[model samples]
Target: IKGKIKHFMWKCYSGILPVSCNLKSKGIQLDEICKTCGEAPETIEHLFFHCSKSMQIWTLAPVTWEGLQEDTQNFRGWWNKLCTMKASRMSDSRIEMTAHILWWIWKDRNWWVFQQLKRSAKEVVLLITLLNFILHLSYLNYSDSIFLSLILRFSLHNTHTHTSRPIVRCRATMDAAKSPPSYSLRSKKEPYLPTLQSDLKSRRASKADPNPLGVKTSGKPTDPSRRLRNRCTVSKKSRRRTWSFGYADPIHLKRLGMWLNLMIRKSYFNILNTNKLKSRKTTWIGIFVKGSRFPVAIPFATSWDNDVVLVKVSPRKHNVLAMFFVEITSAIFVCLFYRQCLPGSLSPKKAAGKIVLCFSGNGSRAGKGAEVKRARGAGLILADSETYGSLFLAEAHLLPATSVTYKDALKIYEYIQSTKNPTARIVPAKTRIPAKPAPFMTAFTSRGPNPIFPYILKPDITAPGLNILAAWSEVSGPTYFVDDHRFVKYNILSGTSMSTPHVAGALALLKAIHPDWSSAALRSALMTTADLIDNEGNPITDAYGKPADPFQYGSGHFNPTKAADPGLIYNASYTDYLLFLCSIGVHNLSFTKCPKNPPHPFNLNYPSLAIPNLNGTVTVVRTVTNVGCRGPGVYIASIQPPPGIFVKIRPSILNFSRAGEKKSFTITIKTEGGFTGTIEKGEYSFGWYKWSGDIHVVQSPMAVSIL
Candidate 1:
């Protein structure tokens, strides 16, 4: 029956099993001479499955097909009963395949003894191929019948590709839940047979993983409880990517360490490249500075370190330089790349509606003052020599030259202002040259030992000016070029002149926002609202670096943001001017004896009266008493007050310039009554200089009797 099973199950184990039978060495040869038994041979299975020593296996095979129909002698009858059993086609096929595989094992055992090339069934089963094949089959299907169909298909396809209805022989088959295959080989025969017990123990270990797909062959248990209990868990190590300077970039890795920016342009180039890296999420930021403008790079950088990000910034303007740094730390960190604070430059033409700035002597040589003067004059001439209507307003009145030169220049400027020549109008302004010869000062001439006034206040109101490394005009002389003999394309300059333009530029920005503001209005707003705080949030200082003396810093440094929002400004007018004059005690001139009504104070409403409340006034007076006419009515004085401030004179009008070459004007001032104050108790008097020109006062305001 076993032999028949092998022959019929040929298709199921086609490539896996051998054709011939060989179990004789075990003394279980099916037929050494079978001509008369009329029974088929008892081969491996006949010797085992039918033999009493192997009864347990047969009993386990199936109850009905165990041994009821025929005794061990009827091999043909056993075969018939096995094949006729009622079971699924796949079940029958699996049984057939298993039986054939056993036959192959028996054959291999014989070959090991004779052919000396065989391995035990268990050893061969343990081969990686058997397990791998079974796993592959499991992937395709997971039922008992699925394996049987696969076997049939394998055999039939191997032979003709179109075989149908192949006969299969099976002794008996049992139903078992589909599972991965397990095989055990029959090794050396056992001497003692133990009693058959029905009890079966599960082969799985306590730590075995329930998930077959995740099963590990390393023998480590994957049970959830075991995993939870194990304290020494291993975590996968994170991978890092690195990039070195001047090295070829690796294919798909981001840099791990910080990239140091050494070369100027190259450094910015790397920043730009890294910021725009393919598949990377980085920010694009840039900063550029002009050589002759502000130096915002290094000094500002003193407060920062390498880890702080700085994106690439190129000075787009001529005579400019920049730096760019990129952080490829991660997508999140890369976002900060563009936040680098970068300074930018603007030309006067480009700065319309924006603060316009121009610095003189930024390129002047001063060891030879004459040469410097000549150069300046030449430059000034060129400014007009340019196109017909250049609008570079002349601010010559504000130059920081000697007082005599400054005065002379003002006179010349007044002359020019009185003309209609198209070439004679530039913005009048103060020159903000720094003191000479200091390490960081401009090359202007030095001031006197104790000039009484030190100019060009320090920390010139934080403008976008720094060591503005910018593109210089390469066409210029080599002295202006870089050390490498490149074109004269960069420079560094200083002064309040440098600082002033920063304010002017900010003004341009404000102008762009509010175009209708008057010049005085704009100026007032800028001054009154400027920040009093230093860069470190400390109080701003005077030229002497002391806490803010008003004269030095004038209102304050120009505050762009604050200037934009000034709530109110002291708007001055021509009338306001007259009022200010009257308030300063410019009441009458008869005291100088030049004229009783000296030209009637051209721009005043009441040229002969006293300004109201002139106590805080700047004034002078002269008194002359009569030697003759010693009566009360002999002396009479009249006065007139100025307009706008409504200044009232006590005598209404004053007249007494010719009382013995010493005329006296009694001008009593009336404080604007509606005014409210502590009204500090005091008496007042006055004095005067000349009636028509510069004058000196003989006596201050005198205290009078109060009732």
Candidate 2:
């Protein structure tokens, strides 16, 4: 049963109990001064709830009743509005405790004012908690829900004052668990965060997420990587007085899962409307940066480091001197769209440094650096025609460029129209931007630079792993979480494990097409074929949603179609792998003989090249096998060297007449003479090597970390 004080207060909020003020307004009250305060007007609310002493008691409470909208003035309206939020609003012990305290305050006031038997307050807070504990134990005598019984058993006491709900304690416990396991945070001198087992008892699982992808989603109860915003650092612990309750009630546990956040704010603006995008996203939507006080926009479009110089075309006529507002209908590579720019009426000779602002619904697929270099545009910016958002552009385009939302473009356009020089500053952050637009790094996704072997990278490739619908046991819930309650034939799961099957499936397809391809050749094909740009045409980012380094996403996202028909493969046999292991100091002297002169660590036949440390000059050797996509294929090299470095490749041209012809090439990297060492700390300069062959344009990324 609910507490007597709480039940009485519920009636008052429900308008059943006649408040003194309403009664007085109806000419029923004999005195106007409150009986408890004597200073304020006598009202039902003031006498029991609004008195200074009642408010003080509320302020002193360890836990509080929150999630109540402050707009409602009357008690009945507020109560009814709160109930309408959920069809089945679960129990909130904190609210009940609040009602009980208000009731006690009213009782104490009556005793002092009418009976003249003044006790300071009706009861101390501990006594009320004790009442709740005793009453909770009583529920086990008749209740039959096992999960409910557990909640009641552990709900007797809580130390979670840091948050409105007990989830604060749950998160803190999970974080502490990640800390050194030798000691427990619960055993510390300060108050410890409580466990989740008790808090989870109150949350009721919904029937199923209404989205079509609901079947493929899973829930995360304790993800330490995702921290709660505005969470308090301090908390209090309930006094430890030994208490236990026998198991008398039982309830079946059910699955609890929700879809991965899409982060797209719901809007009604048509995607095709060039000027009518209405963005509801406000400044308050972003989270606070770690050290910065101000919140940043979650980039819906890729952003660049440089500040934008918003410019508009001259109204008279299309001139080459004026910027070409390119509108690309379609393209396979995002960078390739720049080449599609047609010269305006202005002479091509004077259009060398003109800025081009591209308007597109597909702003996500913006140009990378190499493409910008070829197009020779001074700078570029993509404006979405549908919704307001920034694209989180990661892959560095040589030309300074950024993307803006359709709504923001409208703002820029308005500013341009008003002022002759559109001088609004749009500095989209390259990294450390919020959301990075919404945190995408899930806890289940593995991260590296391998801990054991710091030199080698982990996560060689990545495919979509989040909320994937996969085969499952008939008896299990769709989610793998222990608390999940749903039962379905297929389950939505996420983790490093999900990627394994994807790669395995791709490899199987490749094998079916060409059974003779070696394992290394297959791997090389996948690495080279993988798309360097994301669906948005921006560089793929890490779990944090920030632009990722090579260590995070080796090569890039997988492109299955390209991988299946890779024209050039880095064909490495078992001998190559053996030598790679030897270079890493893996050798057996007693059981197996070790080679004295092992292959250089950088000489492995890998699709991508990474020299961890460069002192001055180093040489890397790579051998590729021609797949005979086009007979008698001729290829020429195109090099994009890192800043302050020069690259040289011996025999820049190669011709292959037969399929499966192997050729080796040597690449030498050397620092520019008399060059000043002025790179950011821990920064790795990026460039690429492209071999334009008769039938294929093969590209390989090169990263150089200066020592």
Candidate 3:
């Protein structure tokens, strides 16, 4: 048997095949009734044996044995009986045939459930018989097993017809089969699988493959290199090509024209037209010391120029052995390591005119440089601790300084210990673009279930925050040290301040495109279109390299491109905000103006949802305005409920007849196992809800704080 068939058998015997009964037993909320017969619960035994469809498949199969229809209690026991059958009744060939039949039955069930395509029992039996014959031939000639497997797989996949187009089978000689297979797509009248050449051409033409033959689609581009970095490019040739596409409707063309016009009017195109701006140079620090082949280039964030010069180490050293053997005057000399180079911690006599080595923690990073400067140290070297991981921050120091990761710090320590005369030079900083695993949560970004209004989520969204290079004041020193006089036109900084501008810039662009949209609508567009994954196609991680939650990342990292045309928006007016304030117990609000029975804070029309005190059941209502196509559109609700919670959405399917049409839905949430009274503070779970349509997918993050 093939590996796939063997694995399927193993899953069946282990009772972990994801049948409805098994899924429900494992805490998944779903109907356990058999999807095929719509009768008995879907179990391993029923799905593969007792169901009417399965029984028909078995009866139609070429192989037969007595007691095959008799109840064996479970799939595992039945499988065990089949394996121990004597050759007189069921031969080894017949057993292999049974496995093939079972595999086909399962595949047919999946097709019916997921793809809404069903095949007759006789068709399934015929396919299994053909597969068994192929396997027998492959067993005789083992070299052709690989080729035969491909044929079996394709045959099984192409069994169901989803379109009116005709399917054609292409044959190859045994010698041709020896080489790798190639595909060629024909017209709709003679539909054939796409070849590699056709696939690449389609990708280059569309810049996207909406219906890849067997490839999985991603939110990010298929090829990273093709992605335009740093700036947006709107060329006339590309615009014309876009217009040529027959699928481009009038609304789409109008939006594209508006976006292009906005881009041209903005500084982005102005800089290109005037050629007044240049790409930033890569900045990094190279540390060169004695007894090393090459200098270690460290990625640093600073607005300083590149200058390389050798410097001597401090002559005054603290020996580790001296602490244990106090009387020993002769000890190996080495540079000292200060846990925190706080004010007055370093002695001027020893630190003067030499680079100081400081560990990161306890004190501010810039303050450490200031302390070294106070002691008349020539430069500073800040070594990160293990907890910091690979995250290095760029700071304007009082002196020439750079930070190194914990791994590199250990190497520096080893060199100082081994070298007799430790001397090094600081290389200038340089810049690098398209950093991987980017758009992550910074350690300093504020997180919350809004302290004052817990039902309203705080830190509404995340953006580029770490090691951001921006214009800076030339009058003040980077570190703002009183005695330090160094200044530059540009500086690299990190924190919520840096991240704020990124979101603000994104909003500015969105506003330019949709001037008629309200502030709340613009915010909704940005939040719903945010990216949850990083550049590396993984969940965005925090500074400590842990997967970030809604509290840390809010809706997600900002994506302006997607925000430009959000399919739907959750709009809220001034009255809505006022009502939200009143519902949250704002005392200053006038009772005469406020509604007698204000809606719950959670019911406010926001892109994201947060239930701060979920003790039992809570139902919240949200409304969305269709802003996509002018024609009819339908969206289906998909929920990834938080752990230990059951979420049920009313009217899971939404239908829109025209643009600007509004629809409302209610989400009812409750604990999985009945209420357990108030939960401990700070205990929460995170999830998301997505409304997927033909052309767009609008997603929103959800956070629930257990009470």
For TM-score, the strongest prediction is 3
Which number leads on lDDT? 3
* C-alpha RMSD (angstroms) for model 3: 28.8
**Model 3, which residues run further than 4 Å from truth?**
1-338, 385-387, 406-411, 418-420, 590-592, 629-631, 674-682
What is the full ranking by lDDT, best candidate first? 3, 2, 1
Predictions in order: lDDT: 0.26, 0.44, 0.57
Which sequence of candidate numbers ranks them by TM-score, best first?
A: 3, 2, 1
Candidate 3, pairs of clashing residues? 183-195, 282-430, 282-431, 283-429, 283-430, 283-431, 284-429, 284-430, 678-707, 679-707
TM-score of 1: 0.22
> What tens digits encode model 3's per-residue C-alpha lDDT throughout 1-707?
88999999899889899889989998999999998778799988888766766765654455655554454467787877777774456567767877888898888889889999765553565467545654554223555656656765664454233232221111111111111122111222212111110000001111211111111122211332332111222222221101111111122222221222211010000101111111111000000000000011125331111222222111111231111111211111123555578777888877777667788767677788788778877777677666656567666676666676667666666666665655555544444444655766655433554455567664466766556655655555555555656555656565544554455566556765764565578778888988888877898887667898777667887778998888999986544654565576642321112446778878889888888768889999999999984457899999998877788888999999998899999999887786455545557788899999997899988888667
Q: Is candidate 2 or candidate 3 better by TM-score?
A: 3
Q: Where's the lowest-lDDT run of ten residues in candidate 1?
A: 258-267
How well is each residue in 161-203 modelled by candidate 2, as lDDT tens digits? 3233222111111111122222222223212222111111121
Q: What is the C-alpha lDDT profile of model 1 across 1-707, one tens digit per residue? A: 24655464553234222222343444654543212111334343344333221331221121123233243343344444556553523344334433544444444344544665523221222221122233333234457435644653363224222133211111111111111122111111211101110111111112211212222222222332322110111112311111111111111001100001000000000111111112211100000111012213221110011222212111122222211111111100000121110122222232222111122222222111122222231111111111111111111111111111222233333433454431211111222233111112111211111111111111112332223332334443322312223343444333222343455455555544544343334444454454445554555532223453222232344557766655333232222222322333332211011212232221222111112224443232223322112111133332222221122223322233332232434343334455543333422222111121012111111111111
